[model samples]
Target: MAQPPKGTYEVIHQPNKLKDLVGGPARMDERLIAKAEAALADAVSKIDLAETAKDSIVKLDEAVERLQAEGAEPAGPERTIYTVMHDLRSQGASFGYPMVEKIATSMNRYLELGEPGQRGHNDADAIKAHVDALKAVVATKMKGEAGAIGQQIVAGLYKISRTKSK
Candidate 1:
């Protein structure tokens, strides 16, 4: 496959050769385009939330390290990991993919009630899982079925975002 021009949107111009693996370009279908736009908006909104969660976790880890270094009792950030897990769970559901949504939900539940160390460990694992899920969804578009699959997936995602969970 030919590499897309720098800063250009045309990554794979041909429509018949399956340019993208997961779905086609957003322009191929109005519903897909709108869905993509909504997903992107949600991702942007969640970025700061995720970052804050990550920062809190990092601070907690640092605090633990410092306490260990000084032979003092460990005190970590409170509930940030759970909050992040919850947000990621909701986002996965909101973005479609029931499988990913399910995983996130499980992780969120773990974070919510697990022991402190368990929450921290699960937080990192959840982040990696969600990242991988997103990468898989965005990797490539389907060939002859691109338009149909794109429309279906986008519509499903939009429905999830608008009706399933808040």
Candidate 2:
């Protein structure tokens, strides 16, 4: 068999084309959503809390502070902090501390995209925002604080990153 020219390939627009899949505004069962959210809250509340999360958060705060002092020079301490952040990202949700998970996830995402110890201001500020939020979450013992304020925190951080960060 002979190979075809590699200049181009066909474009499939079917996925992009909106073929009248809907004729009106989307509908959602608010009751179901509310009920599911209530169930999730209940389950999260029942989770066995890990005392170590608070201690780790304190350490995480210290690490972030060190990173701040370092000023965008990625190194051992920074990496350690990010690793801890990653752990929080995974464990917080499971331990009924979804705020921790959310803040950690956001911090991890920032670190993933924006390097520390370089272009330091935006990343530092954003990371601090997440850290501050996580501090609140951990200190508050994972209450219902992971609501609108969390989203607002992320949004503000995102804005800061977009405006000044690489």
Candidate 3:
């Protein structure tokens, strides 16, 4: 696919290119890396435990359900959910997990097409699937085997969060 114009979001899929850009796995002090990894995992776990993702999924589900119940086409909040899903899809691929990026892209496509009947025609199931996939990737990284790629992703997110806070 052609590259997205400057300032526009694009899904990048070349793992080799990403690895090059991110730098190949570098050896580091095991204990220090482990500590950082633990801290990052804790942060992500807290996010999950707060149910922010689950709540988003539930909101979209409810919106779809309400539309179906009312015998009206999905609107308003449902479209907003799709818009959010689209924005998320655009960024997810750059976060280090190709699988997650793929799932998010699929979810975006499904929502863009107006979620067809499968599990009550709700896109929530698809959204949940993407969330679950991302969680799985994070879980693997938390196991200490994700190596440098995982560490970089976590550290980058933390850094971004810190910058935004300031």
Candidate 4:
């Protein structure tokens, strides 16, 4: 290998365009941050979990009907039900509705148990119970654990799911 001649090499530094756009140093304006936080709080306050839950319940009902009517054939309606419940489970806590998340989590677990596409008659009943619980939680505007009654409701649903899965 041939070596480069001395005094013929040069080193160059490239500036970050993104950092320059954001005013560099990764420093944010406190006033801008405060405004952003206020806006976020306003947006979060406007998020009506009840309304979203109600919509999810409707979707669940439709999916359950489709499942019962279509029977357990491969993924079919079970997949649809799972998808809806998954969304409910994921968003419940973020929206300040832990009960919704808990119920949906139980339902998701029940759906995952046993055979992939072999939901029994009892399984349908269990799903209906979960849906009903979701409706009740939303109707009563239950929020965050919901004290003793909420605990009972979640526990009862989990028990039902376990029994039905077995």
Candidate 4 lDDT tens digits, 1-166: 9987987777788878888788847757999899999997787689888887677788888867765664445356667778888998877867789999999999889988855467654467788888889988889888889999999999999998787656
Q: Give the TM-score of candidate 2.
A: 0.58
Q: Kindly list the per-residue Cα lDDT of model 2 for residues 45-147, writing each as its tens digit.
A: 6664456676677777777677677344545555666888888777776666666776776666666664544445435566677777777767667644457
TM-score of 3: 0.34
Instruction: Please provide TM-scores, in order, for all candidate models, with all chains considered together.
Output: 0.29, 0.58, 0.34, 0.71
**Candidate no. 4 TM-score:** 0.71
Worst 10 residues of 4 by lDDT: 67-76
Highest TM-score, which number? 4
What's the ranking of the predictions by lDDT, best on top?
Answer: 4, 2, 3, 1
Name the regions of candidate 1 deviating beyond 4 angstroms.
1-78, 115-166
Candidate 1 steric clashes:
7
lDDT (C-alpha) at residue 49 in model 4: 87
> Model 4's lDDT to the true fold?
0.81
Task: For model 4, name the residue pairs that clash.
Answer: none
lDDT tens digits by residue: candidate 3, 109-159: 555443333223344444444445445554453333256765555444334
Q: Rate residue 125 of model 4 by lDDT.
A: 71
Q: After superposition, how far is residue 143 of candidate 4 from its true place, in Å?
A: 1.7
